[model samples]
Target chain A: MSRLIRGNAVSADDWTELDDATAVPSTAKVIVSLARWRAERETLAAATAIGVRVDNSADIQTLWPELRDLPLVALEFPKSGDGRAFSQARLLREHCGYQGEIRAIGDVQRDHLQAMQRCGFDAFVPRDDQDLDDCLRALHEFDLAYQRAARDDLPLVWRLRRQA
Target chain B: MYRYDEYDQKLVDERVAQFRDQTRRFLAGQLGEDEFRALRLRNGLYIQRFAPMLRIAIPYGLLSAAQMRMLAHIARKYDKGYGHFTTRQNIQFNWPKLPEVPDLLADLATVQMHAIQTSGNCIRNITADHLAGVANDELVDPRPYCELTRQWSSFHPEFNWLPRKFKFAFSASLNDRAATRVHDIGVHLVKNDAGELGYTIYVGGGLGRMPMLGHKIREFLPEVDLFSYLEAILRIYNLQGRRDNIHRARIKVLVKALGPEKFIELVEAEWAQIKDSYLKLLPQDIERMKGRFDVPAYVDETAADDGSYTAKLAADSKFAAWAKRNLRAHVRPGYAAVFVSLKANGVAPGDVTDAQMDALADLAEQYSFSELRATHDQNLVLADVARKDMYALWQRLSELGLATPNIGLLTDLICCPGLDFCSLANAGSIGVAQDIFDRFEDFDYQHDIGEIKLKMSGCMNGCGHHTVGHIGILGVDKSGEEWYQVTLGGSAENDAALGDRTGPSFSRADIAPAIEKIIQVYLEQRDGAEESFLHTYRRVGMGPFKARLYAKVSAETEVAA
Candidate 1:
């Protein structure tokens, strides 16, 4: 079983990720590829607790119409160095106003956790080789940030200086 | 110079601590070499030819006297009693040990300095006009914007993993001293029709194997929208820039692939969404940043000149020669900016010894307002020296061997730490520089040659900015042997152009003679002493120079046959 981090804690994962080839079980809390979702939208429409997984290259603006109805949007990082997912996650949150859980999936590691968090990824399915506890600690590596991002409550230090 | 606030200091401190932990983890065998490499690179620690090289960011090339002392200390303690200032206006400690890099960074933090984002596939150090505030020609100061951009791009969560290294340069002068046309993002501080301050933004400029000048994407970006617009451009680049091929990964390639118009459209579309977001700068925000860089306490010098300056010039031709080449026009009357030439003969260009650095720091304190600026041409500037102090300062600098009387001459060439230090170099660039310096040892000869930018790079990486040099030299490897290629008529200034290749490559032995031939051709072909080398080249269009360069080789070949 994969270790999943939700918010700040390692939590038990209930959602099942199914690739494009897999048939979706009607009653299960399942996540499917964006392609499969498009193909079987009418069928998956009645199913509850459904999520969609999109590639980093997929334009999030195209999914803005359906973002509010979705509970989870999983962004892929095919390689750890490929940071397109960070932009995707930010656009989903800041521009698309995506309020649902943004999950980081493939190749997610401890080093990327804090930055991923800042970019609005609340759920991280870390790679199997990484220790879950170590990755959990990485989420809070930086207590302060220089700029305001998806998480508005976190201080924008420069703006705070004006008030001070 | 802008001082670091509590927020800036805390960020650097936290970054050092984070890197310390990361280094510890790597040493403890928890992190693999590949993983550790990525982490260390962002902190500007590179496993170079012999030892790890740590590049420290002197943001916008501005350094305080205390900071210079710290650099001197770091040089003596950590490096080989010397440091190399790079073309990007940062300093490099070549012999830093890997395990001790975190400690070095921690030491840097005490003086509001860090190596964060100095390397790696991220935004590198932001550079601006070295003559930012003091130049008489500047319309506005560009350092405040550079500082603001520096803060915004520091560990930017989204941009830290760009497709390749990104660089930004800012210029506000009519003459482009910062080489603004050849950066990833070149910002020119300009005024719109309403006389309101704004930026004219250039995108996708870079130099490497494929050197391309930046294209103007935005004619007028309102001052308040700097960050938001920068974010939009970086966002598009991060999301869409090519990553499969390392050579083709720079933003320049993306701009080339999807013509400039499409790139502008995408950035504008993204900017429209986040323009009014938290990243927007309010009037107070601009004022707050501007306040940090308010002009230094310049002494009233209207009646300060006691005619001794003119008297000394007439009395000592040596002092006059130094003044003619080394002194720059400052906006403040009776005050001048001084260039402490790092191109003194025999030493490596841009290499300052520990003792020299310490003494230079003292000189900065005594002359300029305890502040120094590093030029992109691999030299340092004391930005505000009184005209009366010119003779005294020159004497002190000459005693230190820092006054070389060659500022823009052929000898004051910009060079990279080539094969001697860099693992990427194909040949040793410093030796070639020395040979040329030895050839042109005569100051009278160089002064007659007049304002030639001779730049060289070890490889196609163009770290020495060979592409933009008026006379460019590139080191190439041929069958495990080093060969040098020369290009002529390139420049990094307002009329920036890539140098044209001058025939075939030359061996290490013949490179200096080949350069002599090129200069000989220029002297013979030039219109008059009044016409610069660049102007003569433009008028003649490389025919006479190329013929003269290759004719001797053909004659030798015929003689051998």
Candidate 2:
């Protein structure tokens, strides 16, 4: 029952996140844990508009080939200081070329929103009690970036040289 | 020095604004302390023992005269009228107010300086040989590569919060003045047999509680694949480095745990996938970065033995002594690099007063092409002083109390700001250094003893590089008292090796006398005065020094009993 910042604006979250042991409802927008997705792969593959949640501990490379066509992939940050999910989000976008929707869930705060977005997290379910407006404002904090990420096609070095 | 472009300027400015907002949020109690601690540390703000210490990065230790003047002004206006230059080539104000750090950062950004990544669990400042562009034996100037790495590592999204703090050092000369062997990643820029530029990459070297020399991973990684290789290594470390224990989280431990062979395999596996990415540096990109570091103009004159210079040397023996010690051979024939000793008697090793800083700024404008550098030994350098202007510069520097003729002598010790300033320090380092200096106060005795690196660290963090000193002193806490453990034969040069610990630890009062006794052994049993303390220690093993130190300690204990 919370709003998510999806692709630069607040959006109504229609998806229902099901625990690993929960039963998947037919024709409902549902997100399941990586374990549940793997355990019920053939059954969940036939469902409509389904997503999978990958924990920071799980390797995103293992979910490839079968989970490539999912409409949504939510990466979890178990702790604010643990940045393993930032790499996972980049691997999903740049490595796997999954272009549907990448959401950042668990421990997401205003300080992490911009970097998370640059690494290809389009939807953010911020940590509870953080202001949504502040998280949105964090996106515009930096106008220039030095390295190339999933958001920028070319690095600032190349772009600056081209401009000159 | 690399000049910032419009993009670089804007990036720093925006970062300042971002941190300002973050500080506001933290003050408003919206952001928790744990979350704000990580952000503040990345920007080089530390809540220290007495007050907040703000470390401002001097990229590759290069600074313009204007920047030095600004630092002096900040020291005068913000905190006390002094600032401490660190071994990482950054200046730290130990008494800055917590709320005023953002404004101080804004002031630094005006001078094209920022403290970004100076601390925290990310890549720290990319240090180079202080004599980088001016060194006679340098293969290539390391500043360009350092700047490139700095930009790549700044605000890097994935590696921002690594398992522990990472450090990188670059050296291009035969002598490893940058201490490359003691860093997490040591890049030695070299030209291959084919006359093409490449790098010899070393990984897993670090100094702390566990000191291990870096293992050479790749002997010839091409210049173009530098960033890709670095990214590959960092990705491996980020994913695999230990996160359960903060003490064992540095990449060195991971490299040791997996062994260099397995670590290389993992990094190569990762590199095979991402080698073709946009992180690869193009020739034009290298050229563009190099263009920012244009060489300064030099006069075409040889360093002839002029009558005036000879007469000055003959007239003042002190000037001759200072010249023999403080001057280094510059790449330019007529010029010499001057090492301004910050380790004057009784003063803290790297602490400089505002007046001294302003005087150095003025001197840089007058003689050294308006440029200065902070050496890793916590000293300042005027890198382009002319041979003819040497005497005049020495006279002026003497007037400022900076003309100490102990550049590489026994008294030129690198001592950390220990318990006086650092909250993590277990004992006082500067007090011990002062004690050693008082014992060896005679210039003639110091010159006679010759070429001994006496480094002291207040704690096991080894910021003072005590592990690699020829005579290393580590401050330990024995219950509630400060005790020092001495080591022998460590070096940070091309033949880098960790020192072996001498017998048992000594009390703070007995530490200096124990060192004197060790030096006494070297003096008595050396081949000649030509043999340095290190060479002598190497030739005759540590047995003699250990025996002498312990004999004295036993006699003193027996007398007390």
Candidate 3:
């Protein structure tokens, strides 16, 4: 179950898992990643998107146009604590206007979905081991913000001070 | 003190959201640990040995009593019951959870404060002479320029990504209490024969591994060109500072590599282009900023008020002693600057309790202009208290156990929190400080011994700034045991110099006795009480003190030799 919790309001879990054995059509879509690829461009290019483990922030610009055109771009979280990707995500949206589904995959905890949402992570592929229902509750950590992100069209602080 | 304008507020508010997003992504696996550590450190957060620690910024060490109370409340709710003030005069909370940081920042925001640039490779909190407006010796208040530097340096486009942390300290008077010589940039506010408020800028000074005093490149940079001159120096350093090794990343290293003559030439080259830029001072804006610091009005008083104070002074011998030592004369006729000792017996040198913070705020409101200043020597000050009110204020402060009457005496020591809080320290400085304080509790006896500057650093990194103390003690590790090293004749003034090493290290138990021996030697050989401990040591040298330290009757007679 995977339902969105917007702001402080929590919604019930509603996402269903699709089993690999049950999936049938050739046109069926599934999230593929860098780790899942067995070979080079011959096989890896068949996936929806390619996730590069960015150490420094310079890599996003190098791979921008391909990622911009990809139908599904699942950004890999190599570890649970690295933050270079947030800047990368911002560059994709603000600088590149990346409109593809920016899915957060790997080590995705329930407590992190809301922030991932704000940083333009529209979808998430939760780790297969964690309970899916618990991950959705991670969204409503805070209902307010002082800055704008990809989630909101206007920076809240600008709005407040402009009115002031 | 300059209050935060709308621009500063918006910057911090946005930065908070930025940190929140960074924290979120790191948790969800979009970001990694090492990268987040750097980002979190930029926001002044560190995961300590026990829990997360937060270092809060006290801009130029100027905070109102009300602001101090807000810090006190934060300590009570989000951290342990107390906070440690560093040599740079910032406060550090030993216990804070990573999850509550946003809330903690919000709490600080209510008090017009945040932990911006307290750490990381960015321009740090600007510092100035703690006795800024009230000190009689000062020609001009350094607070306005410090505030200007604070705003200019914050979120600097290029300097934010400097190789290592940067610190800038300013001094406007003869007595350089700001430790200006040992900062990244030490600005000495000076006046030419014409009485213009110019600055003598010293660049590339720092104290970590290779402690170097800054070299002056510009002698009388007028007030209008101060910003341009500073910006020139920063830009050069940002471009040339070594990035290969973190230890070699400071501006000192850059300046050292370039040498002083080359450094000055490079700075001048950069400044020539920006001398007329918008960053250069506008006279009206300077006036606008300066207007924020107008002195409080004082009423005329006669010697009759002085007579009553004299009677109170006569009635309480203790009060007389405290008034003589702890009180400083102000430039105004009926005003005095009050010294509040943070170094009480058994407590850490700079630890202030929540109760004390509240009391200080009350005292500031009732007496001074609701203002307080944190000195570099780990003392808080009420800047403009009336002379007539001094006796009553002293009595009230005495009730709070703060009228120590040991300012600049043997007990007026600077100490670090060392092993008790800092993970990088070699020894427990607070414990040694307590032991020394208990040993020298008799104020009269301490006063009789004369002014001795006893400084302790937990480690060689010099956050405790032991290198510039009159009697400097550096905690060292030898064979897994904590030992203390002694240095003699250091001073932070017009003739500023680093102390010379005394001898081999002493064990934890031997530290106090070692200090005692040095003082004992000073007492035995001083020319007079007028010659303070530092002067006597400078005249006599460390040889006499070293002889007295190791000449002790060792209880080992060939048992090991």
Candidate 4:
């Protein structure tokens, strides 16, 4: 069983990812690939607790408008160096206004947590080799950041000015 | 020149603590080698050919005297008694133990300097004109904007892990001293038709295996929209740049593939969405940032030229020659900017000893208002030297062996740390530079050659900026033997252009002599002494030089068309 760090705690993942061939459960919380969700849109839409797993290269504009009612969106990293997901995550939160859980999956490690969190990822599925505790601690490595991002709309300069 | 605030201090302090822990874990065998490599690279630590090299960012080439003393202290105490100032205005220590780098970084943090994003796939140290606030021809100082960009790009969450390393250079001078056109994002501070200050942004220019000039994306981006516009460009690059191939991963490749028009359209669309976001710069923000770079207290009552200065110039030919070559026109009356040449013969281009660093610190305090700037040519500039003290400074510099009197000559070439220290070099560049220095030992002959930029790179990586050199040299390996390829007519000026290949490569022994042949052709073909090698090469094309270089056609197999 895989565990994910959700809201600063290592929690057992209740959601199951469904492949294209897997039969959709009638009432279970399930995640489906973008392709599967597109192919069986009507069937997946009617089900309770449905989520979509978007690949790093997928066009988020095509999926965001319809994802208004979804509770989860799993973004893929493929590998840690391929960082298209960071932009995708920001676009979903800042531009598309998707407030549901944006979970980072695939190649998610301790080092990637801080940056991922800043880009609006509230949930993370740690890599199998990494300890969940270590990944959680990595999120707090730096107490502050320099830029404005999805997590904080005001940059450090503006915040400091306000306090002054 | 921007001092760190409490927030800035906290970020760097936390970063040091984090890296220290990361180092401890790596040393304890808890962290994987590949994973640690990525982490260490973001902090500008690299396992090089000999030892771990640490590059410290000197933001926009500006350094205070106290910070310089700390650098000298690091050089003396850490590994060696010397450091190399790079073309991007950063200092690299070529021999530091991996375990000791954390301590070195801690030492740097005390002085408000860090190695953050100096070498990873992120926005690097934002560079600006070395003559930023001092040059007379500039429309406005670009350092404040550079500082803002530096802060914004540092630890940027969404853009840090890009497909390739990004670089930014800012220039406001009439002369493109910062080499903005060859950077990932080049910002030129310009005034619009209504006399309102703005930026002309250039996108996708770089100098690696495939060299390309940046395309002008925005002719006039208003001052308030700087960060928003920059963020839009960076976001597009982060998401869309090719990640599968390392060589073709730079933003230049993406911009080219999409075409400038299409790329501009995408950036404009993205900018339209984020124009009024929090990333937008407020007027007060710009004013506050500018306050940090406030002009130094310059002496207002000094004479334009004293009798003693004129007498000294008339008396000493050597002092006159040095002054002619090294002095730049300062905007402040009675003050002249002095370039301390690091390209002295028999020395590596930018390597300064610990003793020299300390002495230069003393000189900066005594002569130039306690500030120094690292130039793109790998030299140092005392930006506010008084005119009356010129002779005295020259005499002192002469004693220190810094009076090389060859600022723009052939001997003053840009050579990368090739096979000597770099792990990626195909051939050794320092030895070739030494050979050329030996050949052009005559100061008068070098003066005749005029302003010819001779830049060399060890490989196709182009860290030496070979593509923009007027006489560019690229080292290639031929069956385990070192060979050199030559290019002519490259310039990194306002009208930047990639150098054309002269012909087939030359052997290690033949490289210097081949350069002699090229210079010989230039001397014979030039209109007069007033016409520089670059101008003559441009006017006549590469035909005469190529004809001379490949005259022994039987010896060479492939000839450039």
Judging by TM-score against the true structure, name the best candidate: 1
lDDT of 2: 0.89
In TM-score terms, candidate 2 sits at 0.97
Which 10-residue window of candidate 4 chain B scores lowest in summed lDDT? Answer: B552-561
| Candidate 3 lDDT tens digits, B5-27 | 56566667756766777687777
lDDT of 2 by residue, B223-338 (tens): 99998899889988888888899889999999999999999998898888888888888888888889998577777665432346668889999999998899899988778899
lDDT (10s digit) by residue, model 1, range B306-420: 5789999999999999999998999998888999999999999999999988998898889888999999999999999888888888999999999999999999999999999
Residue pairs with backbone atoms closer than 3 Å in model 1 (clashes): none
Off by over 4 Å in 4: A25-27, A42-47, A153-155, B301-306, B553-561
Q: What is the TM-score of chain A alone in each candidate?
A: 0.92, 0.90, 0.65, 0.91
Give the Cα error of residue B139 in candidate 1, in Å: 1.0
What is the fraction of true interface contacts found in candidate 1? Answer: 0.59
Query: In angstroms, how far off is B47's CA in candidate 1?
Result: 0.5
Residue-level lDDT tens digits of model 2 in A2-59: 7889867877788888887777787778899877887888787666778989878666
> Which DockQ values do the candidates obtain, in the order shown?
0.74, 0.70, 0.04, 0.76
Per-candidate local distance difference test: 0.91, 0.89, 0.74, 0.90
Worst 10 residues of 2 chain B by lDDT: B300-309
Superposed Cα deviation of residue B86, candidate 1 (Å) = 0.2
What docking grade does candidate 2 earn? medium
Listed in order, each prediction's TM-score against the native is 0.98, 0.97, 0.78, 0.97
